[model samples]
Target: MPYPDKFNDSYSETKADAEKLVMRANGREGLLTCCIRPSSIFGPGDKLMVPSLVAAARAGKSKYIIGDGNNYYDFTYVENVAYGHVCAEKTLSSEDGAKIAAGKTYFITNMEPIKFWEFMSLILEGLGYERPSVKIPVSVMMPVAHVVEWTYQKFAKYGMKVPQLTPSRIRLLSCNRTFSCSRAKEQLGYEPLVSLKDGVKRTVESYSHLQAQNHRSISKASIFLGNGNLAKTVLWEDAKQTVTVLLLLAVIYYHLFTCGYTFITAMAKLLSLTALFLFIHGMLPSNLYSPLLSLFICCIYLLSND
Candidate 1:
């Protein structure tokens, strides 16, 4: 599926086979051609999926799960994907295989279907980032994501980065997208070379710099050490996280009291604000140290908005 600001995601497979028509036309010229489609490929060397997730987590934009967190997806580990390729290559070279598997497409995966958000949580927590707990139902987020995508499309020439909350991306997140690897298993004897857990661990370990604890510890000294102790110890234990929660509360306070906005209207507005924040936060360049700190600054900026 194509995410906002990217025809690449939607067009990748076609692009990968851009010369397929030529190959097909010149086929039986002793050409054995096949395509291996791997789902959500991730592992130590992954350049897209894992990096993007880490960026969102560090930016505090991964707090909201865009659905019920029940969507099932197949994530293919890099090693497993490579193994599938080897199987395909060997199969294509065999005596009985040349005519049979050529000009075919095979879906390769770890073959373990996991709830999408659970998979996300495992990766996040493994890297020491907090797992997402808030559920933003697709109904609330879809329209917002669409607007982000459309806006990016319109303003890309003016330096808008491709938005991360594209409607296509919401669809990808909020839907079940598991693929069966039975064909590859039988035809090519392809088996996953690594389990999903190990793959996630390896991927998380590969990105040592993004480790969540790398953030400097926030000052924990509270003004009222005894009376404020309860909220401090139980709810706002982490000073930085507490600051964000306070910001959220402040926004709610202003809308409910000062602004005189209707309760429902205030809530709708809050939800919209949350979505916009996630969109901008997720689009931030996952650079070294800069955007990470900028994310906390943005959270503090939310107080000014209130």
Candidate 2:
């Protein structure tokens, strides 16, 4: 494969540089070295990929497909990657095999080029989450990702945490990344022991704590919000209530703290305004009438529509 003149990210750039360095030192000082490039290494002990997927799922972000969802990817199991390394080392042990394998790079995969979104769906479904059904085009997501990446680049040093969405990641999610493992198989005798299907099943089963059923624990705030069918509809539990409270707190903070007035004075003024408003509104027909019945119906409507 032809190397690009410019890489999308530093991670890819560094990997390519490291491979070049390793290949350069292949025959020097009687040292044998070869680079084994594994495609999307994932399995039971995976920390980054699986955890990130679960986090996205919980955050309600995993319902989106970044592209048409037909891009092919070669995902190698973690054990298969390790086995590839072993194969490279064993190949280097023999003179004939060393000539063919050393000073070279070999792509390692499960040899199962599955549709990228299909693989993601399998994992998400296995973990008891809804499969991503909404297709979003790459062109639509790329500009947003670029803006986010640019923001992160500027604010990253100012206590801003790294963002997950970026242009490179968008490309990764939408582009085909399958690589042929013919070189590895022919030169180093490398073949995946675990199939991709079994690897995904094992990976999903390993992260049992991230399952949807295990994640839906009722919080204290939900209990305080009445915890009935009507309450659930109106408050919508943590996602909605938490956001509402945060916005409310921001307003309160600006008024009470950022303003010139003292905290006690601001509190008194706020309470006074609240009491006056409630007193006036309490005399209204809407409040005097069956408010519960009206509120219940409104909540039901919002719940159904939402």
- The candidate maximizing TM-score is 2
TM-score of 2: 0.74
TM-score to native of every candidate shown:
0.66, 0.74
Clashing pairs in 1: none
Residue pairs with backbone atoms closer than 3 Å in model 2 (clashes):
none
Clashes of 1: 0
Global lDDT of model 1: 0.75
On residues 201-259, what C-alpha lDDT tens digit does candidate 2 reach at each position? 89999999889899885556655654543355456543333433443355466558766
